[model samples]
Target: MIPGRDFPGKTALVLLTSLAVVISPALAFAHTGESGLVLLLPTDYYLLGGTLAVLASFCLIFLWPAARLERLCAASLPIGSLRVPSQTAISAIACLFLTALILSGLFGSRDPRSNPLPVTIWSVWWGSFVFVQAACGDLWYYLNPSIAPSRLVRSLLRRPAALLRYPGWLGHWPAILSFGFFSWLELVDLAPDDPTRLARFVLLYLGVTIAGMVLFGEDIWLARGDPFSFFLRLLAHLSPIDPRPMPADPARRRLFLVLPGSRLFHLPALTLSGTLFVLMTLSSVSFDGLSRTFRWLSLAGINPLEFPGRSAVLAFNTTGLFGVWLVVAAAYLGVIALGQLINPTWRLVRAAGLLVISIVPIALAYHFAHYLTILLMELQYVVQIYGDPLDRGWNPLGLQPNFVTASFLNDYHAVSIIWNLQAGAVVLGHLVAVAVAHVLNARLGGTGWRAVVAQVPLAILMVLYTLFGLWLLAAPNIG
Candidate 1:
C-alpha cells in the first residue's frame, strides 16, 4: 500500500453522509415533538445501561486472551471477485445527478423542506446514504463526481500526470477543513437549507473538487485533499466488506466478507493529520449535538422556547464548535499520553495512530445515533419530492404526491423503537470500539497486567463517551 494512497470521504457523510444529520438548521425543529418526546422516555436508564455495557466489554477483553482477540480482529469470511460497474460511467451519472440537484436548488421551491436539493443532499445523501456506505464498503468510490470527469478534462487538456505532486505534509488538512466548514454550514450558517445558498455551496464544493482534481490528478488530489471523498474513504474502513483491498491492481482486488472493522488492521497507520481528521469526524458531530442542547442555547443567551433562528447564536456555535473539537482532541491525546505514561514501552505516535482506529466505530455510532431520526423523517419528503421534483406536482413515479406521513413519529410505540435503536447504536459502537482497542492492545501492548493497565484509560474514555453520546441523544433542546 502506498503511504499517501486512499482517502477521507466520498463525503463532505459523512452520515458529510454525519453529512448524515447534515440535518438542516431550518429543519432542526421539523421533528421537534418527536425528539422532545424522547425527553419523557427512560433515557437515563438507557444511558446507564450503555455505560455498563461498554464497561463489560472492557472487562471481558481484559480477561480474554490477547491472541484470541487478535484472531477475532483478524477473522474474515473470504468472498470472491467483486464485479463493479464502469467507474467513469457511474461517476459521470453521479455528476450529472449532482448538477440537476444544483439546478434544482437554484430554481426549486423556496421552502427548504420543499426543495429537492436540500432534501436530497441532507436527507437522502447525508442522512441515510452515509450509514449504509459506512457499513458496507466504499460505495462512494464509484460515485465521486470528480474522478472520471476530471480525468476526461485532463485527457482533453493532454496533461497526463498532475502539474505538481500533492505535498504529503499538507496531509488531510484540506479534508479536515472541508468537513469543518461543511459542519458549520450544517450547524451554524443560517439558511443553509435555503435552496439558493445550498446551490452556491454545492457549486463551490464541486468547482473546488473538480479544479483540485484537474490540477492535482484525480486519484492523488481526492486521496490527499477533497473533503467529502477523504471523509467517506476513511469511514469505509469500518465497513464489513472489503471491496478493493488492493487498489493498485484492480483485477487483484478480491472482496471479503470480513468482521466489521477487520479492515482497520489492513489500513496503514494514520498520520497526525489523518488522526486529527478522524477526530474532526467525531468532534464535528459532537458539537452539532452539543450546539442544539438547551444548555448551549442558554449559554448563548437564547431562550429555548422563543429561540431565535441560527443567525442569533451563530457566533456562539462557531466558538462552541471549535471549542468542543479542542476539548475532544485534547482529552483524546491526553489519555493517550496517560496510557503511554502507564506503559512506557509503546511509542507515543505509534500508540496514538494505531489506537485511533478504535475511535471509528464511535464516530459512526454518533452519526447513526444523531441522524437516524432525520433520515427516517426526511426520507418521506425525499420520496414526496421525487413525485414532483419541479414542484409541478408531477407524479412521474405514480407515488403519493406530498404524501409524507408523520403518524409514525406521533405513535408512542413506534418512537419507543426508534429511541431504543438510537441508544443501541451508541452502545454498540462503544462496545465495538472497546473490542477494537483490545485487539490493538493484543498486537501492541503484549499481554496481562501491563496491557490491561495501558488500556484502562482508553476504556474509561470509551465509557464516558458512551454516556456522553447517550446524554446528547436524550437531552432536550430548542429543536
Candidate 2:
C-alpha cells in the first residue's frame, strides 16, 4: 500500500476492447453477396428487449448495499508467481517470425484476401488477438513482437537510462496522436490492404517505435507513446488476471486473479490527456461502426448503390472521422458539465476521469456487435494461412482448412444465432457499464438521493449509447 507505487490495483471494467473493430477497416469492404456471412438485422422487438434489460440492470443496482458493491470491487486473489520464458529467446523468435511475415507481404500474392500479412494484421491480430488478450490478460507484455525485440536489444547492449527525462506534461499525448494517425491509416488511407503498402507501414512503425524507445526509456515510451501497447494496456484493466509489479523491487511482478473489472478501480486518476485519450477510443470505435452505415455515406454525398473505391471518398470519410470524434467529445463534455451542475461539489476533472471509464463497456459492446461476424468468418482464414504463411499452398500442420462460405451463413438458424449474439453482447456491455457507474456513484457521491442524482447524466448517456450500439448492428448498411 505505497502511495504512487509502481503498481496499484483498480477493479473495474468498461469492456471497450473496441480496439478490435478499429484496426480492420479494409476488411469491412472486402466481402459481398450471400456468399459471405449474412447477419439478419434485429427487429424492433430485439431493440426493445435489449434496452429494457439494460434499464432493469440499472434499477437493480440501487438495491445493492454500498458496502456490498464496494466489496465486489475490492475482491482479489494472488495466484502465485508467473513463470515466463527468457525475454531474449522470445524476442529472437518474434523477430524472425515478423521478418519472414514482412518479406511475405512484400513479395507474396497481390490479392489481400490471399495474402498473409493483411489477414494476419486485420483478422488475426486486431480481430481475434484483441478479443483474446483483453479477456485473458496482458499477453503483449511478453509476446508483443515489437517490444520484445526492442527490450532484448537494449538489454544485451546494456542500454543506459534515457538521455532526456520524459515530461509529465506530455502525459499520454504521444499515444493519442499515434492512435489518431493509425486510425487514419486504417480508415482513410487509399491502399491499406495492399500487402506491399501494409508491410511498408509496419516497417515505418517499427522504426518509429524503436527510435522512441531509444529516446525515452522502454517502459515509459511503451506506456505513453506506443498506440497499440497503450490500447492493449487499457483493455488489460478489464481482464480477470492482472500483473502487478512488486512495489519495492520494480524488476519483479506477480499475477493475481480478480473480479473482471476490478483492476481499473486502483488506477491513478487519469490526467486531462489520458481522459481525452479514453474518449478518443470510444469515439473511434463508434465512428468505425457509424461510417459503414448507408446513412453515413449519404451524409458524405456518396450513393450506397454506386459505391466508388475507398480512394474516391477518402476526403469525405476523413472529415467524417474527425467529425465523429469532435461530436462525441463535445457531447461527453456537455454531459459532464451537466453532471457538475447537478452536484455543485463534484469537480470537473475528477468527474471526467471517473465517468469516462464507464464508456469502456459500451465501446467493447459495439465492437462485438459490429465485428463478431468478421471474427467468426475470417478466423478460418487465419488458421488456413498459418501453415503456409508464405502462401506456398503447403499445409505443414496437416490441418484441414475449413473455410466458411455464404452457404454457412445463409442457414436461417445460423443467422438467428449470430444476430442474437450481436444483440446479447451489446446489451451485456451496457449492463456492465451501468454496474460500473453504480460503483462509482457509491464511492464518489456518498449515500442516499444525492448519490443517485450524481449519476443521472452519465446514466442517461449510457442508455443512449446502448440504444445507438444496438441500432448500428441491426440498421441497414451499405456494406
Top-lDDT candidate index = 1
Task: Tell me the tens digit of each residue's lDDT in model 1 across 23-90.
Answer: 22111111122363445547556556555555555665566665555554554555677556788899
lDDT of 1 at 180: 87
What residue runs in model 2 are displaced by over 4 Å at the alpha carbon?
1-47, 76-81, 152-159, 243-256, 395-402, 442-447
* Model 1 clash tally, residue pairs: 25
lDDT of 2 at 92: 64
TM accuracy, model 2? 0.84
| Global lDDT of each candidate | 0.72, 0.68
Query: Which whole-number lDDT from 0 to 100 does residue 110 have in model 2?
Result: 83
TM-score per candidate, chains pooled = 0.86, 0.84
CA lDDT of 419 in candidate 1?
Answer: 65
Encode model 2's per-residue lDDT on 71-154: one tens digit a residue: 655656676655555665776677677777788789988877678888888777776777777698877766666766676567
After the best TM-score superposition of candidate 2, give how far the Cα of residue 271 lies from its true spot, in angstroms.
1.5
